[model samples]
Target: MSGPACVIRSDQAGICLFVRLTPKASRNAIGDVVANANGQMQLRVSVTAVPENGKANQVLIKLLAKAAKCPKSSVRIASGQTDRNKTLLIDGNPEELMAQISQLSGRTDT
Candidate 1:
């Protein structure tokens, strides 16, 4: 599939990651960047943790931290906590984080 426009962006705080989280999946993984029905791009993430009592969300944070090579405390769910789609804020050097994200998603354009 063709890549979406952009799934990660830098702001005053740090890098903002758009994500579509799949809880209770067979395995935990970070998938490609995909566009939503409205054409907004988001990273695809799947975790085996069930979506209850913020369990899946916590797992998502840990997964992202490992993938991004950052501390788990640096990752936070900025929005969409109760939904499949979520916005994650990673605290660190935006450039470095963006580079890692691009490499992980296999998109050079971003």
Candidate 2:
């Protein structure tokens, strides 16, 4: 499979965000935009929660929801539930969500 095509993208369902999660981090926060070996961009996310029983995933959703100014219910993992890399689907206006994420990540490619 290919690396993440984009860090964030507008989707019919809302917005799709590619992220690399750092569980058991010192703190819960969103970092800068970064590229992988395949030159795919993804947001950096870190959380103090452990990577077990979906704890880290839950924290990730909450962190992103707050960053995007959206409700936690509006955010869900579209893929990579059991991996450090994840694709999140935030339910909202695609343009608005993309803009928010772009601002958050300091990347306007979206």
The best candidate by lDDT is: 1
> Best-fitting candidate, measured by TM-score?
1
RMSD of 1: 3.0
**lDDT to native, each model:** 0.90, 0.89
lDDT of 2 by residue, 15-61 (tens): 88999999999999899988877787889999999999999999999
lDDT of 1: 0.90
lDDT measured at residue 107 in model 1 versus the true structure, 0 to 100:
79
- Residue pairs with clashing backbones, model 2: none
lDDT of 1 at 93: 92
Each prediction's total of clashing residue pairs, residues at least 3 apart in sequence or on different chains, is: 0, 0
Error of 1 at 54 (Å): 0.5
